[model samples]
Target: MNKIKKIGIIGAGNMGEALISGFLKSKIFSPQDVYASEIIEKRRKYITDNYHIESFDDTKKLVERSDLIIISVKPHNVKDVLESIRDNITPEKILVSIAAGIKLDFIRKNLPEGIPIIRVMPNIACFVREGMIAICPSDNTPKEKLEAVKEVLSILGRTIILDEKYFDAVTGLVGSGPAYIYLIIEALSDAGVRLGLPRDIAITLSAQTILGAGKMVLEINEHPAKLKDMVVTPGGTTIEGLLEMERGRVRATIIDAVIKATERAKELSKA
Candidate 1:
């Protein structure tokens, strides 16, 4: 519950590495204050050599030394990681998990009684420090501790505190959202290429257009429909493109994609 002086990450994958990178880049914690546990020798060596942080093959050792622990392993590996470090978890230490489909209750059941658990769902965008992260804390998590975690998460991107009940929806919307956006960008680039534009230029234009549109939504604080209306002059090219998109049921397809992904997330939680 005290200020986090030392942090340990349980995985060395992209998300784990991203957090480490963000933390160091933000100067919230120094490399010596951060530690990571990776099973692979090469990964451990790489993290230590590149980041100058302590790396270990033993999860228990990292848990023992860290004031806060972040579990960034895959969804299926969460329970095993919890079990391995269960005894090391104490009331004084806060635990955070970024694994999708893993719930706070599941983590609590795996750990010692009354251990504070925080569930986080961060998108792939976190790798670039432009992510949208959702955090859900267990009933036992102290307000101060949760705020401390939020401060650390802010370095990665925007952070929102939400009810655990909405996590599946968040998982679908933001967790899987990047892949959907990437697909849209790819399709737009392909369409440009088909229209005789250079492939590289098409990709750059497509990506930047999506980026600008997103920035407008965030900065203008207006409904996206209003923005679309502003772009559609009567009998214009934009309207023709909009009509084609409507004919293809693009909106419905995207909605279905999120729904289907949410359903799969629920299934994974049960598994």
Candidate 2:
């Protein structure tokens, strides 16, 4: 049996709904086991209608009903959400915050003492149960409690344990990584269209190519550089594209993008 019998999501926005979708899809929990609270009637209705889960605008009631509460609201709205239901959150309940840039200490400060809070950085892929989730628990969070969070997260995707210090980078790299890949996909689709492929075919080809390449890298268990060499046969057309990418500084630019996003997350933490 799952330790998490009832789970409540405080915000039924994109990430929250995605979590709900992935969780139910995993069959680790059923619709009756899920709960959500969304201020937006349309989003709340969507969750209830599609997932058939109970949801309301009352965060306090949601907290009361759920033993495992997920704070999935936006970073800017985190403080307000915490404030509204801090008293209802007891030590027994495990609070998991998925709002990027929010630290364990900040959530700890907002809640009563002894609340086992876990900070998780989950990517957009959680919508499809293929996310890479990074988890860091607060000081003194019980080993079993941490494990419980991990168990819940495992259904969504891979979970890695790390120090809280690395969370901002995880937020930048994984939490925001999907968007970068999406941009790449979009560019590839456009490039295909420019090369005379139909738009729909271009999109499918671009998406599938990226997906296949990523799957190869994972399943092959070889260094990415080695994998790249495999694709770049002697004097092949791939080398021309690789050379152009080198000239365009694609590698360095991606590095810079992650760094910039990490810095921004740190800034948000301070705010």
Candidate 3:
């Protein structure tokens, strides 16, 4: 395995900060082993004071110094960032990007030929080390580099190595799925509060219920319909509630959201 001595993360936004936190908590890389570049002074100061990592305002300089470079900037600005560091990229360094809509080919063509590139899509849960991250390496990448990428991603939540063809769907189902669940949690908590439960208690119960239910599906490995049948008894309260959900078309709406989001992700790639 190749030793990743130093890692550079461009863009000090939420994703970048989350990656830094996971790296420290997992103890995979020390503060000195990480470097960050942020245009904002406040973000720069936060990383410097909190993690003690070297900070840079120049993206190209950061890429030159680190063995692994993570591009965490917005999709629209990915072109700009790649152009800035295109000349600095070398075959020895690995470039990993978390920007959606920026494909592996774009990164490969914009940078030096044969430079190792890994395109990833990770959610905000990574900050707490429970994130689901997708890793799709460029075809030119060697097995050794792919393994290294997997090791780093394991620090977050579950890491899956997938073909680039499924990236957009992955982005829809997992990447944007959190926000959908968050909305559901909030609505459930609000309903509890309307029934006279304390606000904090309602929120706590709602969150735990969702978490436990999610764990059940994963651990039991049963079809969701079978699980739903187990909960709905003949003329019981669960059946009554489920009937209301069916009447409201909740399932259909949720399914549509994932489909729409997946389509949008595909559209982004085109642009």
Candidate 4:
């Protein structure tokens, strides 16, 4: 990451701008080290005004100037963006695609052979630097280059390296994971409100509880079941609630959610 100087993002939409935000928040890369290309003038202005990073409308120029280029455009727009910038990509430069369902081979076909490419699945939590990112690099990607990418990504949150085969699962688990958690939080908040808590207090308590539970699982170095046991005293109030949730099949439904989402991602990839 220290060796790589400029990071360019094409398509300064939500995810593209989020990457820029993450880069700046990381403190490893300053605004000067970031560049972007956005078709939308408003978004371009937003990037410069908010982050103080230079942005352009010319994709090729962005590629030519950047050390590592991230393709953050929509999946349907990937081919055109690649075609527009492919010639500018050199062997020493790294190209990363964060668009969901956009495969490495799909990106490779439009670029010169031996140009290293990386595919990443990152969630919305990236905006807050608490993201879960899954990275899969093309075979041509050098080991040292991959390490640099990992180092750069660490600021955003935890990263996992998996075979591209598991990316759809990653998408379901971590990429779309935040939305699932939000749904649970909402449900909990609503339950609190039903139990006579004020809306504002209910929401805050629900959110904090979720956040605290997640931190405990992560920081405690123990399995979640053991943690659950620590909370669920024998024949207590917690057990009664757990039994009710079990009766409602909540656990299986959550598992099915990820599975169903993964299947949908696989379908989208084929499309």
Model 1 scores worst on lDDT over the 10 consecutive residues at 20-29
Ranking of candidates on TM-score, top first: 2, 4, 3, 1
Pairs that clash in candidate 2: none
Residue 150 of model 3 has an lDDT of 83
Model 4 quality (TM-score)? 0.94
Clashing pairs in 4: none
TM-scores for all candidates: the values are: 0.94, 0.97, 0.94, 0.94
In order of listing, the candidates' clash counts read 0, 0, 0, 0
Give the alpha carbon lDDT tens digit for every residue of 1-271 in model 3.
5468788999988899989888888887889888999989998999899888899988877987898999999888888888988887898889999987779998887887889999999988888898999999998888898898788788888899988999998888888888999999999999999999998999999999998888889899999889889988898999889889999999999999999999999988999
Q: What's model 3's overall lDDT?
A: 0.89
Where model 1 places Cα greater than 4 Å from the true spot, the runs are none
Q: What is the per-residue lDDT of model 1 for residues 99-169, given as tens digits with 9 covering 90 to 100? A: 88998888988889877789999987776678999999999998898998888788789999999999988
lDDT by residue for model 2 (1-271), tens: 4577889999998899889999999987899889999999988888899999999988988888887999999999999999998878888889999998899989888888898999999987998999999998888789888888899899999899989899889988999999999999999999999999998999999999998988998899988899899889798899999999999999999999999999999999999
Candidate 2 versus truth, CA RMSD in Å, comes to 1.1
- Candidate 3: which stretches are off by over 4 Å? none
Evaluate residue 124 in candidate 4 and report its C-alpha lDDT on the 0 to 100 scale.
80
lDDT of 4: 0.89
Candidate 1 colliding pairs, count? 0
lDDT of each: 0.91, 0.91, 0.89, 0.89
Please give the RMSD of candidate 3 to the true structure: 1.6
Candidate 2, residue 69: Cα displacement in angstroms equals 0.5
